[model samples]
Target: MQAPGGAILEGFIDLLVEDGDGLRVVDYKTDQVALKEVDERFAGYRLQGAAYALLAAGVTGRPVTRVDFVFTDSGEVRSLAGAELAVQVAEIRTRLERAPGEEPSGGGDDQLRLPGLNGS
Candidate 1:
């Protein structure tokens, strides 16, 4: 599903592996990078992965315990699971919810509060 601001909030997954008492969400990455780069962009990609995990969890109801970001550029894949992704999703959701309304924020009738500003 896409959010009001054109952000996609769901996606598909490749595999759901079960490890006896635990589960794992398998993903693929084709990027070439180190863990440092991944750490830097955690917030950038967390939403996308969390969206996928949420959708998957809704369908499975087993709690998506893992999220894998397989970068297709450097063969480096990162994972953010459990509470980490949850926090990211929460942050994103909060930001989205608190975002400005459809109306713009600057330059409006109220902005002309100063006297003699309209060539009067």
Candidate 2:
């Protein structure tokens, strides 16, 4: 779903848990292989988690400290928590706020100078 402000937030989480520490964003996957890092599936889910965290924080008035992805098929669960998740969310929000032609910090597309196209 798209946020009212126009951010294209995608993916719906399976569950959200909250307690004294903070909110925990949980998403279930039925993949055959388990994921260990921020690959495509993980990246997509991470954004979804961040969006959920934002919504939960607004409602509860407390920061969300965790986001998790559970692969039921493999029975493997991976999680990103605390300040790290917060930082990731912030970084994603920054990317969403960027205007056209504005490159992200640390040079994403600048590294590849397409041989003959730009006289490399």
Best by TM-score: 2
Query: Of the candidates shown, which would achieve the greatest lDDT relative to the real structure?
Result: 2
Tens-digit lDDT track of model 1 for 4-86:
34433344566677744445665654445566676666545665565556556656667777777666666566787767878
lDDT of 2 by residue, 13-111 (tens): 567787567778777776565455325456555545665666556566787788787778767776767776877668656654654334333321222
| Model 2 residue 84 CA deviation in Å | 1.6
Off by over 4 Å in 1: 1-9, 19-22, 31-36, 72-75, 92-120
lDDT of each candidate versus the true structure: 0.53, 0.57
Candidate 2: which pairs clash?
A: none
Per-candidate TM-score against the hidden true structure? 0.53, 0.60
- Provide the clashing-pair count of each candidate structure: 13, 0
